[model samples]
Target chain A: MSENRPLILVTNDDGINAPGIRALIEVMNTLGDVMVVAPDSPQSGMGHAITINDTLYCNSINVIKDAPHKEYSCSGTPVDCVKIAVNEILKRKPDLCVSGINHGSNSSINVIYSGTMSAAVEAGTQGIPSIGFSLLDYSLEADFGPSKKFVKAIAQQTLKNGLPKGVVLNVNIPKLNASEINGIKICRQANAHWEEKFDKRTNPVGRDYYWLSGEFVNDDEGEDTDEWALRNGYVSVVPVQFDLTAYRAMDELNSWELK
Target chain B: MSENRPLILVTNDDGINAPGIRALIEVMNTLGDVMVVAPDSPQSGMGHAITINDTLYCNSINVIKDAPHKEYSCSGTPVDCVKIAVNEILKRKPDLCVSGINHGSNSSINVIYSGTMSAAVEAGTQGIPSIGFSLLDYSLEADFGPSKKFVKAIAQQTLKNGLPKGVVLNVNIPKLNASEINGIKICRQANAHWEEKFDKRTNPVGRDYYWLSGEFVNDDEGEDTDEWALRNGYVSVVPVQFDLTAYRAMDELNSWELK
Candidate 1:
């Protein structure tokens, strides 16, 4: 390995202007030549979706004044942004791809709904070492000071030693002061879910309408879960992969009669 | 279990008006008391997306004349429709929630990008037995006749023998005549991906734009994979679950030093 800097590609589900991505970009700048190709708008629950039905438009944007890194805002999903970056924008395959420093937690089952992690997963599918970072706070004005140093440390370690093949990291930082942060924990996604409740209403034209509302219910009491780590004020890092196969159940499923 | 028929919830990624769903509705009608709450428009690549950022609209529709099923057109993603149907529409947890008979194959990696599978996954999360059905063809005029009996059989089996907890089935029917089908094969999702190629172009004002394009590439040569089942003209049933944990890599990741 050369002593020279690594090439890092940074993107997020939150729009480029979101403070979360800005903080992530700042951290990446200290480690490598960073390229930013992120969505033009918030793409929060996009999962692994790509913009197959529309034309994509990407334009160079000047976000940080006098910063050497290049940035682009693309009219696509987070996964689309990664595809365009690797296949069209970037001149070479990046040494690493980091998505988010997102404004909300993607711990537990929420990872399935996350656009932030989807970007990282998309990179992993293309054989790039990647990590997606999220904070437990969802507010636009949420403080990111607690996460900066930890984010930098994780990114540096990942750059120094690449991740396992076909695996990406889903890191969720707790919302706390830097001094109060209880360090990092390698954890698994908790078995948690949103208990959905729809608020029903009638439109002005007498049509019934509803608004989706939910309460997060974490039933898993495992200490080695991302939810536990975040709840206890530690940054949680879960090694995630794109393969959806439940390998343990394969034999059982195969034994079932098809007729 | 009572001798009385089961109550089934039916939906699809394609809108309530799509011919593919209409055919599925017809097949499901013979099974039980079917209630359809599906999106009002096509949502092909919606993935596990939900309509959290917007208000939802669901109106009872009289789409199919003389059909003995309750149907509603929803202004939301497939996942959203499932949420609304379960939380607001249904009096109790459904015996079965079947999505699709979709116009395209959601076998292998396509499962991660499918709204149909998302609907089924959503139902599974709620402890409901669910399945997402798809055809190997993408034509709007594709025939569902060949796979109707198989689809009914699978749904009936799921209703009769409850799925092992926390699992949902992703069933893909090969596009072939009934007599030509080589029965069903319970399989695992193959290691497959789309080799993305962005179609670059210049707009009327000479700004560079792109259209996302790709070709499916199957890397797994295993005969027990979903890809192989489809290739051999057999219906592929992959038992899928939403827990995205890579358990084998957990220990290796835990060994990494965070400090």
Candidate 2:
């Protein structure tokens, strides 16, 4: 590791201008020399997608004040932003990569649809210690004040003690007053899902259309889950990895007939 | 279970007109009632994205002949298609939702970026037995002839015996002749990744741009991996799930100091 301040790369799924990323940039500014390379537009549910089929355009945007950090807006997904940041922008392998203070929760099943988590996962895949921060609130005016200290602490800790290889942290902060917020809790991703309800309507062209709508349902009653942590007004940090292999079921599945 | 033919929902990430989906549709027609609600345009690498920010349109199109399967071209992501198909199009919950016969392999880390696998995962979340099929080739004219029998067999088996809840199969057929191909192998996702190399170029206006380029690097030497199966010319069947929890690391992570 470098003797100077750690090089921290910051990005988010909620676009570069979102209040969430701005708050994150402010917090990360206190920790190290930061660089912001995020999407030009909101890419919330992009997952781990990269822009392979199209050319990517990135331009340095002057957004932050006094902070020596560089910022760029990229026309790509969150994963694409991370890849471009690591491979194109940064001079060396970053000491850490942090994504989000996402506008919404990516607590459980929502992780699969999250561009924020995917950026962190992309960083992890490239052997960088990373974390994706999110708030339980989906509102544009969601309070992120409670998360500032927690985000700084987590970043400082990760910088002091590096994470395990292939493991990145998924941090979800409960939307609460800084004083009312409970302590941090490291937990597992809860068993949860979206019960989809599409609102069908007739378009101006007389064609039927639909809008995606859903309600999150958390079924896991376990107290040691991210969902539980948020519910109790605590910041939840779940150590997440990219290996989707369900190792426990591998042997059982192997026994099944392939013919 | 119903006594009549099972209601099978077929879709893909490569758009409704892709040859891979056509091959899959052909195989599905032999087994049961197939309803295809695929993206109107290509959605490869869309991952688990849904059209939440925008409106979605699904138009019933007449494409294939003699199949008698109802098909709709959706203006949304792969996951969105599955959601609309389940919530609006299908009168009842489908027995199966099969996505892809994808133009490329969705093995290992590719699953993280696969719109095809996302469709399958979405179905599994809805408690429908699902599978995502892919070929080893990425060619538009990639032959699906050799794998049809195996695809039919697997779909038939899945229909006959339901998959465990929360588990969906990611099946990648080897791009080889039936005679050259070995049998199916139930495997784990390989610890593989793309080593990204951005192709930089200046546009007409002298602005710099990048084209995402990468080569798949398989570091895992495990013989039981999906990468191994594909390399050995065998069809790889990896039972995948939407749960992203790294269960083994939960306790260890919790031991970290929060203060």
Candidate 3:
């Protein structure tokens, strides 16, 4: 409730103690009063899932020693973190909300299945300026150092200029050093999807089980796409929306014969 | 795979034993050689979540004795069923995929949080023509008789004319009887959201936990919306897509001073 500074709500899908979030927190410390409400455990690929059928547990935590920001860990998905933060944790509406600096890429089609971006979209649904940041690297020791400046720049600019209603940013940083990064490019999500090939195996109990795996396929050759931007060593910023409606197809659907 | 009939994949967010999926199964059986792959447990509100961190169990189950279709119950989210069905269960790609005669409404913004629609979208992502159908009535005993004809018509139409890649239909039916139903309308998703209010309660150990509750708010007055169509006793069909990109906002985002 600082009068001079903006209140920023921070969250991520990689759990409260992930290195990606710590890097995000360090950058947000320079911007405003930050409140982090994240999952107690990693919630990757959870999409926009919420804890409707289950009870939610959210508690204050001090993960970072002497950290300036207030933090809470919740027993829920990334979207649940935002819902609880906005409804139960924060007293007043936050001026901004940012998710991730995620452990891996949320670029292109991954945005549909990303827990990191889902947190951001949830915040955006609640009428807050929100952004989700991700790196192309998937390793736990992935270099988040190069992402700091772009993260700060995007966050600062978002704070300065509010996002339009129903829209949030999905920013994917390429795995390049700060000097090598070719700045930010506002782009469209590339038309892409995972060609899922489930790894099927038999358990010790003689029962079949499946582990979901997939190869990323980007058939979109548009140079003005997130995939293209990331491939060219640029930080791609795609404005994403919660509305699933394909407005362009409405007319085509109307042409169908249905009495 | 018979050349005389189209192959159909039937799934639901509600468990395989739910009356909703059974009704969906009965309807799809009339359309083609149906393969029923649904969650063994109710997965309402699971969104586009996939079981990544956990093992998924799918087994052959005979919920409907001697039913003309092959059925399997999976211990996974609705999206997981689609992945497993396509990758491991089905010998060939399904000609059409239909998800849910869901026990509840997935109209408007609910489409984003719907496991039903997510299942259909997952199918769509895999290049299968798909549709997710729901009735406004959430009761287990809610009559799906009114929706059967419409559902058959829609599925038949989809099988005849394949859906554009990445797009699926999100169909919500009014609770009215088939005779009272006002037919179908191709509509846009209404601009609406859940005004969430968490119900806070203390456990036996005096630890506070919260249950999510929300009021559905539809402020959109557009008559061309799914909400308005459903409210007017019509079956509403909104063409939904997996691409989260806000194409219209790309130009405005491109104008941001990021470099």
What's the i-RMS of each model?
Answer: 1.5, 1.4, 1.1
> What lDDT score is found at residue A99 in candidate 1?
96
Sort candidate 2 into its docking category.
medium
Tell me, by TM-score, which candidate is best.
Answer: 3
Clash count for candidate 1 is: 0
What C-alpha lDDT does candidate 1 achieve relative to the native structure? 0.89
The candidate, 1 or 2, that scores higher on DockQ is 2
What TM-score does model 2 achieve against the real structure?
0.97
Using DockQ, rank the candidates from best to worst.
3, 2, 1
TM-score of each: 0.97, 0.97, 0.98
Candidate 1: regions farther than 4 A off: A1-3, B1-3
Scored by lDDT, model 2 comes in at 0.89
Worst 10 residues of 3 chain A by lDDT: A250-259
User: Per-residue alpha-carbon lDDT of model 2 for A65-86, expressed as tens digits?
Assistant: 6657789999999999999999
Query: How well is each residue in A1-259 modelled by candidate 3, as lDDT tens digits?
Result: 4777989999999999899999999999999999999999999989989899889999999887888899999999999999999988898899999999899999988898899999998888889999999998989999899899999989998999888779999999999888999889989889888888888899998988888888989999999999999999999999999888888787777788886
